[model samples]
Target chain A: MVSELSPTPGARSVSADTEGPRPPMPVKMVIAGGFGVGKTTTVGAISEIEPLTTEASITSVAAGIDDLSHTPEKMTTTVAMDFGCVTLDPTLKLYLFGTPGQERFGFMWDDLVEGALGGLVIVDTRRLDDCYAAVDYFEHREIPFAVAVNAFDGKVEHDLNDVRWALDVGDHVPLTVFDARERGSVRDALLVVLEHALATAQQ
Target chain B: MTVGGGVTKAGTTREVKGEDEMTAGEPSAADDAWGVEHPPSIVRPFLLTAGRIAGGDSLVPTIPIETQVVATDLGLATLDAFVFDQHRDIITICRQPQSLAEIAAKLRMHLNVIRVLADDLRADGQLALYAPQAESARDATVLRRVIDGLRAIPDSRGAIRER
Candidate 1:
């Protein structure tokens, strides 16, 4: 590469203090569930920045049966995705991406899960089924995940055991009740997910 | 006083007013080469990548990039004025290693489009890619650091709500 012009003002200065032996690597943990399952709230609670949003285009091939012959053909469509982030430290930043919970968008998970620490699936007891897709997707991918039943107004509509059984999460999954709006609760819930992630990573 | 969950009595009441709204469905616009008069449409994403549906490399959003030595032979001047501007802006911002996601967000360009353009720049040796060192998602030491970091965060409950 050749230098055409001087770098723009405010370019990061490579100094002894700023440059470390190892460059800071970005790590991400996904916050996933249905559309309104407090994904953004959980991110905002823990993120030092105001949980900025970024969009990614997701393309998936759709297979459908032919109208007359009952044959299968494929189609593709692109959709937008929203995400947020947290700066854990100067060396390691954590990103929290709120993915579409619908199964149709499952094709995009492969990209989202690459190098991800783990996932926290926030479930609303009133809409337990809303999070099933997230749980199933994580389980199938062998990604460590914790199901956090988000409490609304400090109330849990369903029993923890019942919610667990309904979700069919294995005993290995740490299921807990948490308040998404509370930073401490969200932080604690993420801790559980990290513990699971650590155990999984060690194995 | 802060509650155990990090919320102050006053903060909780104020935050409770807003629920997660599906505001993404709202029609949004972006500036194009022509300025604000012609807001970018949905098809603009395709145009950004020159109809290239796929990107070349595994440039994850988190990967960091920095400008290498400048190359006069990169033929940057031969490209469209708008493209040259985008490339120059990217090169300027990436003088110090910046994450790919931040570049996309800051530029207001689609992540995929950034990936394609960044890949093009890398191929021309104008940018250097610094991939994450984590070999696997389950790296034990990295996960431990993550756990410790999350635990170290002081009570942030209602404090964030007010902002």
Candidate 2:
């Protein structure tokens, strides 16, 4: 008889009753960038709750993938990851995860990147090269992403075109300028990522 | 299941992996007891998962769901004192649906640690993880809703808010 009941088609369900408060469908987006590029700040701006940090011990499973040039043969490196959430509706929620762009931390990115809608690779114009690793990883993995040049103090030293050329991201990628400090800007930037995610999903 | 064998009960600190039912150690007195004090900051993070570098890829369980969960009769029967505190906290908040990130934030524990604890509870049927049947990794409708929701948020401009 358990099999006789109709199951929900998309998400995995544990119980069958439909009238009570159900768990919201959890969807996530990633904010990837170099250190101090404001990934955490972007997540914090629009999150319903203050962002939280978690320490994860990333092991050597990523020896070949992560750029280990800085620390060779190191068995493990622990990093503090910041994340926040937005409730889109009673049944849908959006989670924003900020990831460190350092290649050594690429292994941990798997846990965050998988099943995510898309990514916003925040770039600091002053350090144009810092975001190269993120752009490479997201491009190679085929994850839909947008390059948001985070202008600190409402100031961008370089042209967005120059930053884009320096990163050498493909033409298909969406490159836009934004300030990470404002909630509205963060939300709009995420909207762009979601649009890209929607396009990819439909295809 | 018994918990805690080579445990050193020095103050409020104890190793959770040493007490997990899946781990090999035998159950001792402290295995089922709850620590009344906070664990010292010096305790290694891996000790919470019994020295396992990877806590398994079960982030799916942390997905927010609406199924109601009452703590199993077994409850915190075999949890270490510190783990029990977290377990009770989850049970109290989960009376209604909550996301894994919410639980972690409210409890002030690392998300990974909360993941391990939530998995433990699910394994024992002490917690029920309900995921929305209509949602998936790349659902078009869901993505659209997210985009709409983000757009609906009120605009913030002209002032630099402190983060």
Candidate 3:
């Protein structure tokens, strides 16, 4: 009865892996809005690389919602978040995460917004409701954010002030209009959120 | 601002603007790789992780999709140090620093699957994670660096950009 021998004799002396070309520091900001509010488009316009989707599937909810019948019933839907990275410098990387703003996906936001710098809530004037979840989430958490009304075809259905009033945000939130398709427009929109962050941090 | 709810809707946004020009759907892709019919993916994570996948655990300490992981040379040298094939596969992919999302995409597995597996190796000190800032209050210094990075982008649009 010979015992199973070790795969490698005394090969587990793993050394410290902290030398040379350390992995760059990663910082993230979320681009959140309801489906079709141009979260991915906003990421693509300014991302150095194409946006990538990570389908983080959640299986089964807490009791009452969890059906004990079948595997299909127990397994929940896949929560995908598209993200893109910008190499800020050799030592730093900034990630732009396009997250779903639907209420069903709220469970994942705590993890998503953790350590986030801020957020940008993209709005569609015709369907302001699409972005309301995003606006409320950021506000409730007091996470600095800016709301940008994405003017489809360069036309805003509602006036800027009207949208602001409808959102009922304080003077602190920066609300603006930007085109999701234009690279420069998206950049400016992000800057607006960062400006809010800077102001918040300075206080 | 996401409102709270108990409804359990799922599926990442149906599309990511214009990305992932893959030839086909995920279910079929896994089948093709195996060269044999495979069961639905809803069950694969359970089988692969022996029911220890990230979301399945109430306290697995999940990392963000953007978190970068790389293989330590010692882990690479002692390949058998890893317990499962997934661990080895992840270390192979991490020779060059890769985000969890990239590794998941490359392996054609769900992101949470990779999260748990990678974290296992990371916990063993077989891999190093260059993590984002922990859940904490946003700091002015980081925000200032982010602003500077955004400004560094070559203004592709016209001149006289508004500040």
TM-scores for chain B, listed for all candidates = 0.50, 0.47, 0.62
- lDDT comparison, 2 vs 3, better candidate: 3
> What lDDT is obtained when candidate 2 is compared to the true structure?
0.60
| lDDT tens digits by residue: candidate 3, A1-203 | 01222122211111234422356667778898877778878888888877665555434333333233432334344555666788888657778887744544333365567677889998888888777667777887788999998887899888788999988878889999999878888888988998889998888
Per-residue lDDT of candidate 2, residues B1-163 (tens digit): 1123332334222212322221111111221111223333344434444432223333233333122233433443433343545567876676666666556545656556666566556655566555443335477877787787777777575453222
Residue A150's lDDT within candidate 3 is: 89
Models ranked on DockQ: 2, 3, 1
TM-score list, all predictions:
0.70, 0.73, 0.75
The sequence of per-residue lDDT tens digits that candidate 1 reaches over residues B5-83 is 3322442222112111212222122100011122333434434444433321222332222212121223234333334
Q: lDDT of all predictions, in order shown?
A: 0.57, 0.60, 0.65
Candidate 1, superposed: residue stretches over 4 Å from native: A1-23, A59-76, A103-106, B1-38, B41-48, B55-83, B95-97, B157-163
Chain A only TM-scores, each candidate in turn: 0.78, 0.83, 0.80
* DockQ preference between candidates 1 and 2, better one: 2
lDDT of 1 by residue, A1-203 (tens): 12222222212222212221233456778888876777777777776655544444332333221132343422222233445555567666676766645544333466566667789999988888777767877887788899999897898988999998999988999999998878888888888998888877777
Error of 2 at A78 (Å): 2.2
For TM-score, the strongest prediction is: 3
RMSD of each: 13.9, 9.3, 10.7
Model 3 chain A worst lDDT window (10 residues): A6-15
Against the true two-chain complex, what DockQ does each candidate achieve?
A: 0.14, 0.23, 0.20
* Clash pairs detected, candidate 2: A11-B133, A22-B66, A23-B65, A23-B66, B2-B27, B3-B27, B17-B50, B33-B81, B34-B81, B35-B81
**lDDT for model 3:** 0.65
- What is the C-alpha lDDT profile of model 2 across A101-194, one tens digit per residue? 4544445456556667789999888887677767877887788899999988898888878877889987778888888878888877887787
